[model samples]
Target: MSETNRQWLLAKRPDGRPTEDCFEMVEREVPDPGPREVLVRTRYMSVDPYMRGRMRDAESYAEPWDVGEAMRAGVVGEVVESNSPRWEAGDVVNGNLRWADYAVADEDQLVPVDPDRAPISTALGVLGMPGRTAYFGLLDVGRPKPGDTVVVSGAAGAVGSVVGQIAKHAGCRVVGIAGADEKVHWLTGELGFDEAINYRETESVRGALAEACPDGIDVYYDNVGGPITDAAFAHLAVRARVVVCGQISLYNAEERPTGPRKLGELITKRARVEGVLVRDYVERYEEANERLAHWVADGVVQYRETVTEGLENAPDAFLGLFDGVNIGKQVVQVSDPEN
Candidate 1:
């Protein structure tokens, strides 16, 4: 008898707004690690908005996954078998791995995770790429100043939640824009956002933004771009910094949707819109994790996670991003960590 590994593979390229049919589940005999590699049993897996971009046939920042091949994602796992001198059985590690029950990783591909420091799941959320994204996107790119009014779109998400809180810590008036009323309240209440607008309930997002940001938005952290972006641009103050973090709204559109021709406004407002990628600041991850962990401990920063039980539901969890289903970091619990 042989052990089997269950995996999810890309069934086909999506025409527009991928459905569950785009994914296929299969099982294969468990694989053994080669020299300098370790076999890991996955515990937690991450599903993010960026993964939507990967489902396309065209090239992008992330390499597209080939059809019939196992889909890859960020995962925290326990090393069950090791052929590398750097790792051993029972060691906890995390890296970009397959959406499967098990994965084989090279020594350099995975970094050690201290389970005692926090839940191992944090390796896939706040203490991971999402948190690093917020830290760099807000501090380095946005350059938010004290007394500045910072507005965060998708403010209830994994990255947006952190960005808004970090802005608050900077002594900025943090305004959040979310879809649901509870999400909006969560931002204004527990997250310490000065104000939050529920776009779904608002008659006009632009008008609501104008009212919330009476002084004009000094910093705009955009995650879900679309009409919200058009509205946010209209309320920018002089020399505003607009950080283009994620444009999740357009990720599923079959054809490009025409948007407001508002580039001309940048000339008058003297505003700067820049994109931030966490990979660009990979060398500074330790800096961010350390600072963020400190803030979480000091009650200055907070986080949340929406876990989808079982690896079989990973595709469903990923699709939920476009629908704004999850409140914070959306992850899948694949298995329990071995103590």
Candidate 2:
């Protein structure tokens, strides 16, 4: 075991899109676990769009990340040392842990991960928060009925990709809006979406949506807000359900910029718009996890991961989110786990 641990601290609050300067790497001795605690060596660290919001000093759904503190992220790790009855060395675990190679956490703060079931890294991706966000946000909030047209923005991203697939499984005509042509292909070709639009290549998002969704959109699972959301709003069917899972497009906006005023569209279409926070569905996570696992095992649903190697590159992986540099879940590979 290494004598020292390297951690990324929140150096400064980001004014707009975050840069590497906002994070400072610090080295500290790898502390031993005390009573009822375990020392975990991180294997994977997830860098998500939601973390961008947490970088702001203001409070949101989750608390803001304080400057000069180790940034927290969804981490999958292996227990290297244990002082807890429930955990032993070599046990795989997952939790919201600091961005360090090793973390000393109370046993209750860590959840056991079954390496035999799936890749343990999945505990930070498809089997973790992003997957649950997709499941509950689309099913509980969007409420897409069979034969309904379900459109997902940021459709190639982790949550959006899962949202589209789940909507398809529920017998909806799924349309995906992505940034790149390859992402569009992956959605319509492999993931079984009925159609996909490349928002970057298209002349107008609203025009493309009109062409693709000839019957109008019955459900809009929004991951990227801004023009795409406005376009989706313009095509809402009667009683359409809109699921606001993320707004990555607006995450970096320094000043809140206004766009298409469309509250009247909701009134006219009788549409229901609702925002979702994954923490609110924690009580029902096991139900979603079981079902998602079954679907994954049966090949009913698929997922992709864009991984950046090394803990040192974690900040770069985060900056990539705003740049649209990843196709699915963006995670940092910190170390290899012992089998």
Candidate 3:
């Protein structure tokens, strides 16, 4: 094993959209795992929109990342060494890990990944947090009934794509709203969405959405909040359910922008709008993972990944989320597991 470890540190807090300058890559001596800890060699790491919120020194569901500290993400790796009885060298594991070539983590913090069952990278994507977010947010919160019209914003993304698929399985008429024509095509063509709208191309999102859902939208799985959400809110069916999974549209704003006051519409429609965090359902994680794995194995659900090739490009991969550069999950390949 190499004597040095490469790490990406937060150089400064982002003002708006984060830049490469906000991160600094540095090298340090490989860390030794203490008692009850294991040293993992990172193979893949995830770059998600939620991390943007973590950059700011503000209160949220997760703690803010301090400037000058090693950046962290959902990481999958091989156990290089262990001081914990629960793990052994060569064991594959996944966890909330740092953006470094190697990291020392508590044994309790890591979960084993079965390489024979699925690609280890997926432990950070479809079968990981994104999948869980989609499952609980859409099913528990959105609560779409059979034949109901369900629309998902950010439809081509990791979580949104899964949301649309799970809605389909529940017998909903799934409609997806995405940023590009290709994403629109992929959602409807490959993912079995009943319809898809290119929010960026459509001159009137509300009109297009109205046309797609002649019966009106019963469930809206919102990932992008802004005009898209406003447009969705305007077309809600009576007693509709709105799952606020994310607001990527506002993640990079210098100041939170105000838009149409549609709360009155919610009142008129008697709709229920609820915000979701995956951590809220941590107790049921095993239940969700078992079901998601079954769906993937049975071909009842499908997924895609948009991967960046190197650890050095992790920051660029994250910045690309705002630009709609990835079709599904965006992840960074840190190193080959066997290497």
Q: Give lDDT per model, in order.
A: 0.92, 0.91, 0.93
Model 1 per-residue lDDT tens digits across residues 190-230: 99899999999999999999999998999999999999999
RMSD of 2: 1.1
Name the weakest run of 10 consecutive residues (lDDT summed) in model 1: 256-265
- What TM-score does prediction 3 earn? 0.98
lDDT per residue as tens, model 2, 29-102: 99889999999999999998888888998878878988998899999998999999999999989998999999
Residue 121's C-alpha lDDT in candidate 3? 86
Clashes of each: 0, 0, 0
Give the C-alpha miss distance for residue 130 in model 2, angstroms: 0.6
Q: Over 4 Å off in model 3, which ranges?
A: none
**Best-performing candidate as measured by lDDT:** 3
The residue-by-residue lDDT of candidate 3 on 1-339, one tens digit each, is 889999999999999999989999999999999999999999999999999988999997778999998989999999999999999999999999899999999999999999987888889888999999999998898888999999999999999999999999999999999999889899998899999999888999999998999888999999999999999999999999999999999999988986548899888899999999999999999988999999999877899999998889999999999999999999999998557
Worst lDDT 10-window in candidate 2: 254-263
TM-scores for every candidate against the unseen true structure: 0.98, 0.98, 0.98
